[model samples]
Target chain A: MNVLPRRQFIGQCCAAVGATGMMSALSALRATAAAASIPSGNNLPGTEADVASDYRALVCIFLNGGNDASNLIVPYDASGYAAYASARTALALPQSTLLPILPKTSDGRSFALHPSTGELKNLFEGGKLAILANVGTLVEPTTVAQYKAQSVKLPPQLFSHNDQQAQWQSSIPDQPFKTGWGGRMADLVNSLNTNSAVSMSMTLNGVNSFQVGNLISQLSVQPASASSPKGGPVAFARTTGGNNPNRYQTQKDLFTSPQSNLFSSAFGTLSSNAIGNSDALAAALAATGTIATSFPDTSLGNQLKSIAYLISAAGTLKLKRQVFFARIGGWDTHADQVEADVSLGAHAGLLQQVSQAMNAFYNATIELGCANQVTTFTASDFGRTFTSNGDGSDHGWGGHHLVLGGAVKGGDIYGRMPSPVVNGPDDTGLGRWIPTTSVDEYGATLARWFGVSDTNLPVAFPNIGRFAKPNLGFLG
Target chain B: MKPATIYLAVAAGFLLLLLVLRPDAGVATDPRSPRIAAPPAPPASAAPALAASPVASEERSPLADGLNAPAGTVDEDLRIVATLIEVFRSNFPRDGNPTGSNAEITAALTGRNRLRLALVPPDHPALNARGELCDRWGTPFFFHSESRVQTEIRSAGPDRKHWTEDDVVTKQ
Candidate 1:
């Protein structure tokens, strides 16, 4: 019984035309090409589309602004915690507020999450959360002295935003490139799609480096409250006045009339497209009902709601394989640690939202009878320093991340956590700890689980061979 | 005027406007060409010793061709160099366009450190020598500069101001 907002309804009309029209255009182009060529019968294979309607997917939640991983995964063991406590003088999380995690082997080695991650604890206990420790970008295995002396060939711009972002997404830090690991995966497997309405890749966040590819563009989804464009064709299509044999009359009138040049005839077409897509997606979403699973009420929570709604309408979309991108930021605490956490109230709340929403989403899949088919993971630019800069923390490397899904060998920590020692041999003079694990290893593992062949892995992540293990041993 | 005449006049006017805007569309194609011609020579105030700053000796300077580089090739090089410079601003969030994929690059090229290259002439030794430097960086160092000038990488030297005359690893 709830009606969409007036502004939203209009925006939906615009978005519909934009996305659906483009998709239809691309599909038509593809169809023409397909008809011209003989069927290999081996069309684009390996997408969620190729498999059973009940399949799993991987959702990557990237926390921008270099989340302070030092605080997220604290050293819980006696000697390790002491080393952490001493090095992180002002930046240490209190022992009381910590959520203790006891690893399988209690060789007295453990860690704790910040008090803000209560939902994360529940998920971890429920065997849904798996921690990935101390991962970062690396051209090759590098040492601190080598880093300072510049002896090793490293990622082009270390500690750089644009380059690192591209590097993280492309897995090629050295040059301008095409497509991300996920996009490449979709390229390999999108043949299984039933219809062309939904893209294999979906980004709740706007267009990002990770979701862009030479041939693939991420289907951008705005939050529920945000307006989506409308779809379909000309307004007043049913009614026609006078002799309509010639279209010149309307064209003449439009051209002669003075209007906002910025928002002109061309914009009208663009708006129409946007609205078209919004209407299609919205209409598709309405068939979805109160999901049994509950999502958090935060921004990410709302995003998850939309994701769930879309997933509920997956049959309508005719999608087989789907990849989604979403995240929560504000972890850049450089001023007040306590106040930063407070200010990052939305962010902390977002994490809970992610955990709850993901759980709900997973349940919805199970309800749809597709539990083992969906996977979710988290990533960031880099980890924050263990030591706080008085009020907050500074950017550092080798932070912890998490991956969750039914397919993941959940309830365990992967990768080695460095000893939190300031200016130690492992430390790069600053709090930046050398990463034992590379993003290549992490991405390769996910790609492999997503059905990427070992041969295609290097093509997806060129630098994956430089690492000791192509597989991170986390996914089955 | 008759309606047909009005329509004809409007259509003609619109066609003229389209033709006028045609050049404007091309303007978006290459933005660095103007900066390269004048070489906004970073105001003398910032790097006071820039004039006295050591220029590589003829033997050490690969780009002794003067100021000019090949035509469209120079512009291409400028685009790549501009991308590289913008990469530096990525780490400094305070001075960065911490948003999406392309916006960050645009923001980095806006202020004082915005990219520029000066083309001297085809025969300039600096321009000719720059060919070697361009090959080394995997692209031309500066657009329009006969002597290809460029910011040094770690191999050239850590100082961001310096440029290398030779690719040392290939020297042997």
Candidate 2:
């Protein structure tokens, strides 16, 4: 399928451009050819092999460092804020500075968000964002008494960063895991995609734990280079488009050469996939017109913009379902959480970027008429300790999360925030909370909506059976 | 898009291809393997003074030893807590009888020519305990009597959380 356009394109470029752009095109073609020759079969059993008209995608915005969710979603009620401030002391945000929000259920418990999340608040009010509260990794439904008694099973290395991050992505806190919940889900639904060569898992962040599965390794796209032709998002071996036909032909011959060496052949396959996906995706994005909505000129903003571009080209990519992963670090605010103004600081800046990028990306989806089909959620290494260490907070367990989409049941809070009282049942000393809702239940909810059947929910997330509700009802 | 840029990209890819396709490259060797080392275990004996521990001398500010200390946030904090401990130690003699309440010492840290309004991090260790005197990590310096006379001042140190290997202290 790829043999003709690749060779013909190189020939045309060489002829028309007088050797200019021919070499890059030739090498690119060779890479794509290898990429298209993927060793298939990570598909789920009983697949219909039917292309689906309805498209849905899940975008996971992973905050690399442990985010202080306590400060993210705050309480505005007098008694609640008093308790929260008393527990957190100097770490608590000023009550007046908070952006107050009206939740769907007016049960008298008033809530507010970090002031930087103004755009997110707008999204919530506009019925496009839902808050998932007090969610964390859990092996089973656990209680305070059971947690204290050492009676119930707990996630391995409870407070450690690496362990908890794996638990969140893998949904298997008890032991070592290979396949992430995203990759597993992609394997199941990928059969719906017409382009069998392109995997469903994609990440802007180089390699990540969440997008690796037995059947689905991420189609890891390089960040679009400013110098690249048409903001090239593909990671090519070298710059593309030049007058060096001899060098191009040599490189192309080497990449396209039939190999007998096992290791060489394997490397060829990987390079092939990378080059192929890059060629296909880059061309599609270049062909696509400019987006109307403006994305902030930040790293996260650019990544989200790239994701928006890809989602808009869904038909070109022949995608029925896709799982996207992106990361924005510097969330580990162990010190200097805020500034002298109290409203601005490291955490606030990150949150602001998140709000702006998410809002813009949401609008882009609408621009593509795929707004209802895409849902984006935020994840972190873990939540910070509820109580401040003085300047900032340390790592903690349970934290609130945000899920946004047109299809989501917004303006509501799912799960419950444990009492802010340090060592008050919810706290294990310095305010490290035991999670109320497990990651299993959370992933199952998203997976179910992504087209995984009720029976196949456990296949996507192994520990879903331990929790009561498979569907959290956020993605309505 | 330009002639020169495309050449550069192809050249970059060529260099990359050469690197990955190195003849001596080892098979199945991944440099990104996770290194999961266990944290050092907590000390078994809960000695109040913590004097027997090694850090008693290393963490002391030059001011505590009557020498001009280097200026740094951590050193300044250690000096602050050490100053408070010295002040509190003078109030309570070695006889194990309490001379002043925890509040008096906290108020003393607030007064002039002493520890100024040096705000600690929000959830400092002493946030739950009495005194508000905090260390560099914004964690409260752990100040309590072994009995009533000897005072122990501890900072959660770099980790910012108490009771870890990274903890620093005044007077061991």
Candidate 3:
């Protein structure tokens, strides 16, 4: 036989193997195509070498039920407080009880946080937290005039809960929902991970629309429990325990066996991959050591703690990029949202839980040496009305959210803060302020920081070009 | 002829002329006129005669005149009924589900339901003895709703019948 060059021989063997494993080979080829598509002099912040070696994560803490953000972040100045107090009426917090925070940049007005969010106040002062103001779902840049005249397109079902939730997650309000921004971002950067045992996208809570992607599937993992501090992968019932080796083997055979039916074959293949991936992730978590940071014991606290643990196991799993989702509910406070003591009530209690849990999670990241590598952000269905409907506020658009991580340019507020006046210039009516910032701009900022190039930003947020700011600059 | 005799003849001729042309002037029986009859006056017994307190009068004044008099164009009558329903909704925001039947909404407005504050006085002329809200024509108003929050109110107009072309409607 004619002797071929060693490199040529190896290349021929790979091409021959690629023909047999077309699906797996196609993923590798797509990754190569994605890298090749990046034009020279790209807007990505780091060099290609840094992009290949570094790891980053995004944690989305969805505050289920529309959060009454008017109470969460309040005005502290004399005139500003007067306006807020006049609009909110009975729902307003006492001026003296607020936890004061002075942002690095000011719009000639002062502000403060709720009394319950003392931990968050510390994070803000320490330059680890930034506030994003007046952000919400928008079909396009809309003005109060445009809204009243019905000249500009608006997101469908403005105040209803489920529609707004999906709009916030998908970030493509103009189109029918197919994938979430987080899901699309993961699909774009999935090539960064050379040896990920589990999917790059993970949710501590159950499956969510935020992590639904076409190429990559989100792995739903349990929160950290007292028994298992680092939460383990969701396993098959048979694999959990019992001296039934025959049952486990039989289940395995059912998944591995060939099926002539198309549906059955697809099911078998999906089930087999799930089982195999779960086993691999479990093994990886078991081998990795735990971190020393302490976490709170609440539900949200447990979820964040589990995320911190997963971040710790990133090395063992060989993941370069990760995205996480967690959620907390009971924010729909239409009635009895506050007691006679405005500073203390259902809303304040929820804020306290969020502040404490986030503080603990941030400390955990610091201990794991990935404080700058991990960014956690908050989202909600919409903001509550500035004007109270008797005891509580109603659903409104454009709320404030919090962003926290070492990489954040913290101790500052980003986005235009709406004037807290009912039927003011920004108000569409009844204190529902038209959003100054779109969700597309907000998600694109985080996506850019997470290694997505400027050219591919629209793949994640299709409407980012419609908004003035693609990157909100909250992240460094 | 003499002057007195001539004057008397002219007056007689003018009188005859007036009599002959009066039938052609179309005063009461003009076919081209719209001919909207005035709403029937409510019965005297239907009006409430109570010592009015300041609070009760303030709450009752807006609907009191419209309910007691009940004489207006169809659009005006529809406006009164729509305003009544709007006031009811504002006071009891939790009670979003207003029934489509005229008697049911009339009962709720008259303080017969929970939170009995009597948004509309029971003795108001707009309500019949059966406690159903009535149009200017003394016919019960028809209510239709597709959503709990929005209700359409229809007045029977001068014909005093439902589902006719002469009905006036408004939504609240």
Candidate 4:
């Protein structure tokens, strides 16, 4: 062997230990023999080298509680408004308050967004956003007649909160919860992130099904708060530099020490990995510094701001493809959804929060020169009733959603817009519109844009083939 | 004018002053006391205007007398329960607390906490052994929360089983 100096030998040993620690921290995400069996399929029209060189991210903003979609994307034409106003008597917003939009191609009807969603309207007019109408969880495509006749399978527990939320996140409504579509997508494309130490999936909201995967688990990060304004990895208390430097060493030793019991051994390994991961992430984020773009100080704004920071550090973290999850609650508007003015209340406040935060996030992406690379989409448990129940609406089936980015074919409404009439052709009963487009179709489109191939689309969304259009063409 | 007529007018004025001064002169002194007759129901047009007003009304429904005196239809009983729950929710607007389950709601309404809002008396017949608000059919009413404030009250109707055609439902 070649002779080496004492200093060189010590440096090499330290490097070896550090590399081992990083590998152990990300042990779950390593592409082992078992993980190699997962179907990645062939990437879309691109070589592996091309895909590895590029970057893209999918951000999911899950609005907790069933949103009232009837008032969200309203009909603004005279006759359409007449029907909407007739159905939603006291809860209807004034026609003058509605912010009208001219779709690229309309289905013989004009539309306006909720008065509170002015930013969304701006995005629509600027050709950065597109609306997908009447999308919801479905076993397969079913019409009002089939729904009434009970001739087709339906999503289990249609109106309940927890069940519907799981169904929407999983995108596999027919089967019991196995994994979220986001998680599955991450698993398939995780190879793109060649040298990443952290999981490709990160969540601002703690512990969601959307980011739970088989190989790569979600990493929960805190939003910018008063204590830690520039939020990063949630570190353990006093685990770093302190007066008791020996204490940190002792704790690390205890965690990494071998154990006889299986449970203790597992716990020790997890704790050691957590410490290593947190330190690695904190260092990466500190190196990336901060972006100059200003974000709002609200709950959702803080989450999106944190996400923007994380995206800025994607290169430092060695991530090529990433998925993020954020959530905001208080959308369950059973009563007090609107006030006497019909333009302000709980629902309006929530919508404004969503609009402002989303707008800020999109701007931040543009500032980072990744506007065309990142796509943000909105989802909720389900839609609310079209017919108002005195002051608010009840749980319903289908609802509208917003998809926006620089690459979107925006300023247009896709899918079939249901008739506003209660008990109409689209309505099964009580204005619960049967979904014309399934969640599988919507997710498949996003997966395709995120670089998932046609063959691997089924791996992410098993029910995608049941739907006619896998690519909705909203994304360019 | 005669001096006697003037004295009589002064005496009537003094009596009216006494009537106005005495707080208990017009209405029943005790809130728990039975009223001779129920107040007329407010019109449909007035409902929205009075939506945020106080829950205490001059009208006495079967709910005030306890479920033992329930002589109304299932639909009427459900409405009464829903109105009571609505009043409870209005007082405590905090989301997800004391609204998750029937027992929690019962605890809040029956003065088990610091607020001490005796919306439903502890010994009322509407409450079962478990302290849940029961329907006229002697079954606990299912409280489904659409949100923190809005709840759907369902009573297992005549058959005393839930999710059936005869079940009575009301959203508040």
Clashes (backbone N, CA, C under 3 Å), per candidate, total: 80, 19, 0, 0
Q: How far is candidate 1 from the true structure (C-alpha RMSD, Å)?
A: 15.9
**Candidate ranking (DockQ, best to worst):** 2, 1, 4, 3
TM-score between predicted and true chain B, model 1:
0.18
| Tens-place lDDT digits, model 3, residues A425-473 | 8997668878999999999999999999999998988888899999899
Give lDDT tens digits, candidate 4, residues A229-283. 5567655444334435577668768878999999888766656565566556655
TM-score of chain B of 3: 0.60
How does model 4 score on DockQ?
A: 0.02
TM per candidate: 0.61, 0.68, 0.67, 0.70
Q: What is the lDDT of residue A434 in candidate 1?
A: 76
- Model 2, B31-125: lDDT tens per residue? 12222112222233211111111111111112222112235566445554554444323322221211122332343333211112111222334
Candidate 2 vs candidate 3: which has greater DockQ? Answer: 2
Name the top TM-score candidate: 4
Ranking by TM-score: 4, 2, 3, 1
By lDDT, highest first, what's the ranking? 3, 4, 2, 1
- Say which docking band candidate 4 falls in: incorrect
TM-score of chain A of 2: 0.87
TM-score of 4: 0.70
True contacts kept of each: 0.00, 0.00, 0.00, 0.00
Residue A43 of candidate 3: its Cα lDDT?
A: 26
